[model samples]
Target: MTDQPTPRAQRFAGRRVIVTGAAGGLGQVVAELFRAEGAAVVATDVAPAEDVVACDLSDDAAREGFVADALAELGGLDVLCNVAGIQQFAAIGAITADALRRHFDVNALAPLMLAQACAEALVESKGNVVSVASISSVMGQPYNAPYCASKAALLLGMRALGVELATRGVRVNCVSPGGIATPMVEAAAAGLPADTNWDLIARSTSVIPGFMPPADVAEALLYLASDAAASVTGANLVVDRGVVW
Candidate 1:
């Protein structure tokens, strides 16, 4: 087979990327994938680690500082992947204002703020952004009102920004994943009532029969952030295995 044409090189070669929530789970996977694809990656998380820049995204000063540090370290930024989020499950009457605000702060506001901080750099580099939303953003899930609302807001905000930034050559998109088999999902499931019908809730809407993996979502992000998707701004790529349907 003529050596299969020697396969092309990694897609993100020479690109500078910033990935938030890189300490674990989906964020960590996305960051590693970018690095594997030959991108210079600045990985940030709330907890400090030898391989991560610590920044609590809820704090405005810290968030801004993290962006500055990421840019300084990377020299330039071509892609930003906002994958940090919080999820909690509680009955409507049990949901506290603090919990609701926490979801919005981390899931919705932080992504928007990061996008704002990186806007100029993205414009200059003709870069792109990919945010991780949730399938619940489109289809409501019981006992997850706050989480769903926050993700919905994030999804719409990214779409609007995609429009506003198109002329500036900065593309923005979102990836909505459904029931990814991660520690985060396991923890969320553990918090649910013992009587909860997880079977019903986890049912797939597509032909696929199981939970998606973090890497599936990461690949969707890669496509949106890569030059391969040059004309695909203002879109939400649903990696839910057709769960919304």
Candidate 2:
């Protein structure tokens, strides 16, 4: 007897989604998750890849234009996943203004701008927004002042947006993850000073131990974007393996 092909789950079938930072580690996984669940996805990032739109999220005009282009292409938006971010580790005394600006621009401001741009469409569809925050938002980390502050701002903005949009039937939420095995984390680790105490940092934060895989984060995003989480809004789901606790 011939084996029957497994039917694919269609949680987001007939839905339209816009995923920013599509070229980044977590962003790419989030986009793929939406697409696999049958959503029409428009993925944008600073670097272009096949089917990924090249757009810099840091620029105001570029961000606005990207959202417009995405909506035009997708016809409308049902979900917005803000998954792009940058992490730079620098001692507070050594950090430059440019460094701080870069972190906030990409990590905090861009997500707000994208959400603002897509507000009308998302409201029309009764859609949702999911942002990838960080465990750093709630906990201090060595040489990561800018990153933690930016993520904190992002999380707060998401909560405020959730409350404001709740009356309109739009949900907004964020996911805070601990160390995940992503290129971004690797790059941050590589840039760390040789004298940094890796053991101490790990011992303090590695409550559950080991780096989480990107897929785990993607699954969290999927849940927030799916109907299963319809009643969930203004929520911050921590996927850092008990590190935050």
Candidate 3:
């Protein structure tokens, strides 16, 4: 099914939120859902969109600027949803330093940097951070060293933040999805090497078979960001159809 916001109530009424990568795919769905739930969202993405501010998340200056814009537009921060990421697959022999850096910069470092930029605001508002990790983070995925490594880093970083920010009244968590039916995933799967091992892939494949809809994964993210998860912190809620087991 296509991504659609089915907000049942104003769970985030009067909340000020920062949503990265809001231009398309799961990010777009997350932003739409937050707004539908009465959140004043400050959305940004590297890809230019009408309402999404252009911010190259890998750059420190741009991150600071985006945080500034968020604070200015929505006042104080109530939640930070780090939905921006890059997932490029490369076989072990093909993995390079540049590839590793590119993946970590966007997938892992960007989320951590954004959290640091909004730390005080989050603490002040007693808010939380919910990031989108990947099933590769908790499982070994072939031809995806960089993506997997970076996602693992993202998961650890969120856990570290969850502990560091807990006493400050700020929470941090992640939703590690096995796979989502997005253009990014489709392209990566299409570009896999011809000599790829199908049997090895099947070892960790989701029991549900195909990738999940973006909306389904987005729901997990929103749940972690909501007050319904008040006592939850440093948790990596896996929504990967039992892939990690």
Candidate number achieving the greatest TM-score relative to the actual structure: 3
Candidates' TM-scores?
Answer: 0.92, 0.95, 0.95
CA-only RMSD, every prediction: 3.1, 2.1, 2.5
For model 2, the run of ten residues with the poorest summed lDDT? 199-208
lDDT of 1 by residue, 135-226 (tens): 87888787788999999999999999999999999999998898788877778765566667666565534558777888888888998998
Model 3, 1-245: lDDT tens digits are 89985547899999998899899989999999999899999899998997799999999888888788779888899999999998876678887899889999999999999999999999999999999998889878788889989999999998998999999999999988887888888877765778988888787778887888999999998999998999999998888776887
Q: What is the lDDT of residue 236 in candidate 1?
A: 80
Task: Put down candidate 2 lDDT per residue, 55-146, tens digits, no spaces.
Answer: 88999988888888889999999999999999978766778999899999999999998999999999999999999999999888888889
Clashes of each: 0, 0, 0
What ranges in model 1 sit over 4 Å off?
1-8, 194-207
